[model samples]
Target: MASLFAFLRVISLLKAVWTAYSAFYLFRNYLAARKIGLPIRIIPISHTNPFWMLVDRHFISFIRQLPFGHNSFTRYNYRGWELADRYFSHHELGDAFIVVTPGRNWLYIANPDTIVEVFRRRTDFPRCLELTEILNVFGPNMSTVDGLQWKKQRKMTATCFNEQNNEIVWSETLGLANDMINYWSSKALLKTVAHDTRTLSLHVLSKAGFGKSFKFEGHDERKESSPSTSYKDSLQTILENCVLIMALGTKFLENPWLPQGLRRLNEACNAFQKYMTDLYEEEKQAFAEGRTSGRNLMSSLVRASQDEAKTGVGLTENEIYGNMFVFNFAGHDTTAHTFTFALYFLAANPQAQDWIYEELCQVLGDRQPDEWNYGVEFPRLKRCLSIMLETVRLYTPVPVAKWTDTRTQSLNVGAKTVVLPPDTMVIPSYASVQTDPKYWGSETLTWSPSRWIKTSNSTTANLEDEELITPQHGTFIGWSEGSRDCPGRKFSQVEFVGTMAVLFRDWKVDPVTQSGETIETARERVLRLIKSDSAPVLLLQMLHPERAPLVWKRR
Candidate 1:
């Protein structure tokens, strides 16, 4: 006991000394950065400092998540686009208490033209740091690779999202959705408790992406029961474990040097890698047995791996690992939020939901199945879909899109040129542009999907929400710009539509209480979505945030 006590004392002393040193170093760096005219704001707290350390660390992490949902409304996009505006306009939103990592470091680009230039110059700004690192956890999937690696993987992987591939995925996706609808009908008295949009998306991703059938049909004799979780569930457990902890910036939540937290994190990562690696090898064996593809994302990934084997330069396990990371967070979050928010807009404008139903009836019969072939029906529903896109713009799932400076030369920001030392980080402000009075007209802040209707009731035809913003225009960039933009956008679109179409066709979302406060999506400079809590395991293909604060009535 004495020896153990003594060791703890020694460790405590060491941590304190290191923290003091870090504090000194951080301050020195901040001062030097300030002297060089960088936007470096040093925090007064240190990692070893008392409560402030937790505040500083979590606040920073949460700040990054602030551009959307609760955080954005709470903290001003958590200093996101406004941060750039402040950097540009010399306005300080924060006290000295909130510090940036020095220098107008990385890249400070806010103009539409420059946004085009950055996306166009592929090598100049490729592989966003956070995106790439997170992708690494997917075990060498196309999402993690750059250059030839991405290209090769993109080829076979692309097939998985093709119309036919999507048809297969969506069929299963709708099956899950139908099941959920039935379940909700059975348990109408649940009062919609114990549900959220995120879980819905996770369930859909599990089925559509991993091919795990989770019976959403509650106690229905005709419907299969929700299956016990399989490997995909196990894998997801690890994935969620890693993202939640890592995204929160662990040292902030717990002791930085706590072996317990670190070890838990490390274990999650290792377990995930092992699981994915083993699955990949098993797939390789299956391919050798002439099994090219199965029903889910794993099958598609395995097929890609098989193709990669012939090239001898196939995607590394890292790429596979990274993409899993991408799908779990990016794949699920954005689509789920879109699905959820679209429901909010539709409910707010039930006329539009009825409008959507009218279109669905015209395009697809009441009994029409959920398949990619029916994707053609989505265009008729585009007006409603456009409203959904607007929701994404007004409430970006991600607050900022970032890239590390690969430029050897100074990036000229019109009048003032900021020379970005190689490997600096620069995050573009999509949140600002989406809500900016400049591009979106004066009332950009309000939720008005009617703005997307060009002819209104003039009886017009259109395709799925003709992208309001493109990589070319830099308008609303929820999926980001550049070659590194989410390759899964199409996949997300399909999932989102599948989820939305079925819900509107069968149900009416009425407010439970007229006086209930409608929660606005928050936005910090960075964005994190805190979805509504009322959504059930309605396993439509995407996360359905609309589940919150509403009662689903049978139409």
Candidate 2:
């Protein structure tokens, strides 16, 4: 029996290796065969700096014809942020058009109408592809759950984030903001080191999303505010590693012989799974006994998964955890990145930041913490909100969004017919739409909040029959377009607004370093790279020079 089992393992191992190589070769062939339309134009990007150089240029050629079609590339200003843009955008075949990922099972698309249709069908457009590891590693959590399951999970997950629930959540956001802003005001260090906004925001999400209080929020004896060991850092590392191992899954799964790294990763997944299971059980028990209102997000999910009200389809505890992890990555990283990038632009344009601060004080005027929630406080808040929204529009958190259509349906895109069968990779040109001269106006590239306020200077374009999707345009599809977009949108927006209000109400910021650096990172759901080691940091308390540099005094 033992010998037979060993022999079976050997066969499995060889098959996995073969499949991996076959997948790689298939992708290479696709790349070779692909070509761009001649009249459109193509820029040959050197394989070496192709990604970063393009991102450094923000991908929208400032000078269209010169550096574009010539085997060269354009990128974002931040070098680290460019990699994702490269994987997501391509114009002419090899130039800046589509990327034929490995397995040949997916295609990276940037066409405007093609992406719109992909988003239109929530059932068909799944966030995951066969090559994506987020779904496999995390399981059917809210983030990866699709079809009816996603819809159900999204509903259960949303109860905690609605405007009605804002009061409940404000307790946490306001508290954290106070700590963060005040601490910055008191810091002695003129310089500080922290991960880009992605990581910093993760800390905020932990407190807001899962309902944990921040360890580094207020007047601290603590100096460094980064995630400390076992729980925070380890979890982030495991998630990032999940992305890595998934990329190498074919080789690792082959040979039935478990590699040490794979084995270790598996163990971590199991442990993480177990942790989630325990929490679910606890929440379920509390709700059952009527000891808790099931107010936080986890409790809501547990209740729904166990609800007799939910017939036919329901979620498992493990699945909810998987979703929570996705929520963590999406909510945490996207929000944080937006905050960081917004700060970068705001700092670069201090006049806008100052305007925003002045607006806040005008409406807020010695008001108590909860006063901003009422109807009277809206106008000033709206202006501040518009600035943040505009910042995201200018430098979106994610450059590319990729999905696969699982339905045997067709959608019309201009003159072309798109047949989306199961696993058809679809990509959206997010950076283009946000920065399009036609829709947002030629001055769209300029980082100005006044444009979003709908002034005479506010311009509109005829991209589609409907008004271009702006903040005023109902929902910002940057979270995604259509029903299939991120369910966590409302949740993330609230977290962002709450945190920003708290911090900015107390400080002023400007770019003193890493101002022109480009963002670079490996292509995936979330970004992890910073443009440079000297990347810009939001200076604290400009009001009192002697206090903390991270926090400035209110003028």
Give the number of the best model, judged by lDDT: 1
lDDT measured at residue 466 in model 2 versus the true structure, 0 to 100: 19
Q: What lDDT score is found at residue 555 in candidate 2?
A: 57
lDDT of 2 by residue, 1-555 (tens): 999999999999987886677566555535432432211212232212324443543343444456453342333223332323432334324212433333333343444555666676656566653333434455666545466776777766665465544444555555656656655556543232233344445555555455554455332343432222234543555554645544454245334468766655555555555656766888778867867643556666677677734475667655777677776666665665566555545544557767667766666667656566633443236556666677666555543334545455555554655444444445555555565554566675566776765432335522112121244331234666676556666566565666667666667753222334432111110112122221211111011111112224465
Whole-model lDDT, candidate 1? 0.53
Candidate 1 Cα RMSD after full superposition onto the native fold (Å): 8.0
lDDT against the true structure, per candidate, is 0.53, 0.50
- RMSD to the true structure for each prediction, in A, is 8.0, 10.1
Please give the lDDT score at residue 361 for candidate 2: 69
After the best TM-score superposition of candidate 2, give how far the Cα of residue 356 lies from its true spot, in angstroms. 0.7
**TM-score, each model?**
0.69, 0.67
Per-residue lDDT of 128-165 in model 1, one digit per residue for the tens? 54444444444556544556766777765665565654
Q: Identify the leading candidate in terms of TM-score.
A: 1
**Looking at model 1, how many pairs of residues clash?**
52
